[model samples]
Target: MLTIGKLGQAAGVKVPTIRYYEQIGLLPEAERSAGNQRLYSRKALDRLTFVRHARELGFTLDAIRDLLSLSDHPDQPCAAADAIAKAQLAEIEKRLARLASLKVELKRMVAQCAGGSIADCRVIEVLGNHSLCAAEHGPRESEGDS
Candidate 1:
């Protein structure tokens, strides 16, 4: 049996995260010792490790839950898991494209800067007037926020 801290260390997860997973039903509740402290079995350690690995791969908590549910039923097909991985890949590709555009815009802004005072700063001017920006940065999430 492993204490919560030991289980966290073994699984490469933090203690609070393990506790949260238990609360959220990702991990089963650990048995308690005579002193009322949590004690984890090897199964808990393995489950925590799986959860940590999924998180490191950028799976959202909801998707992780789905994957876990699928994993519990050994006879089930893996189409759902495949779909989740494909969706993650598509999201990554979209982010990469956005980041590339952002890089181009930043480079243009930096290249146009003449090291002048703020009154004549190209960077400041471009930032103040979005129309002056060379690339189209799509509407930000907080666009409607004052």
Candidate 2:
């Protein structure tokens, strides 16, 4: 068995994040040692490693939870897992499209400036002028920000 810190270190997550995961039911509550410190089994460490890897792949915590549930029931069909991946892909595509639009607007803003001071900076001017901002983006299109 390992302490919370040790498990976090092994899983490449911070100790607080581990505690938060436990609090949120993503991780199971650990048993206590003689000193009343949280102790984790090898199973807990492996679960945390899986969670970290899934997070690295950009899976949301909700999705990870679903995946974990599916993992617990190996007899279930994989279609739900495929659907989750598809949804993630769709979200990524939307974000990429928004980013491309933002890039164009930012380039335009920069092009308006010719190494001038903040008072004459076109970037600032455009940002300050909400009217100049395109409606295709902004909060409407970008549910997620880069």
Candidate 3:
């Protein structure tokens, strides 16, 4: 059995993140030691590793939960998993396109600059007036609040 700290170290996840996973049901509740400290099994280690990898791949918590459910039932078809991955890929592609548009808009703003004062700055003017933009380069619905 591994203590919570050891499990976190071996999994390359922080102690609080491990606890958060447990709280959110991504990780199963750990066994308790005689002293009331959290103890983990090898299965917990493996599950934490899987969660870490899924997070690294940008899978949302909800998607990870679904994937975990799918993993628990290996006999089931992988279509759901495949669909989740496909949706993630589509989201990435959409973000890439938006980034490309933002890049073009920035380039246009920069190229039009005459190195004048702020009052005559094309970049500032374009920023101040969204209508002057050549394309709709706005933040994604999930972004901007942060």
Off by over 4 Å in 1: 139-146
lDDT of 2 by residue, 1-146 (tens): 99988898899999999999999999888899988999999989888999999898778999999988888888989999889889988888878787898788888877778997999888888889978765457567436563
> On a 0 to 1 TM-score scale, where does candidate 1 land against the true structure?
0.86
Query: In terms of lDDT, which candidate is stronger, 2 or 3?
Result: 3
Task: Indicate the residue-level lDDT of 22 in model 3.
Answer: 86
TM-score of each: 0.86, 0.85, 0.86
Off by over 4 Å in 3: 138-146
**How accurate locally, in lDDT, is each candidate?**
0.85, 0.86, 0.89
Best to worst by TM-score, what's the order? 1, 3, 2
TM-score between candidate 3 and the true structure = 0.86
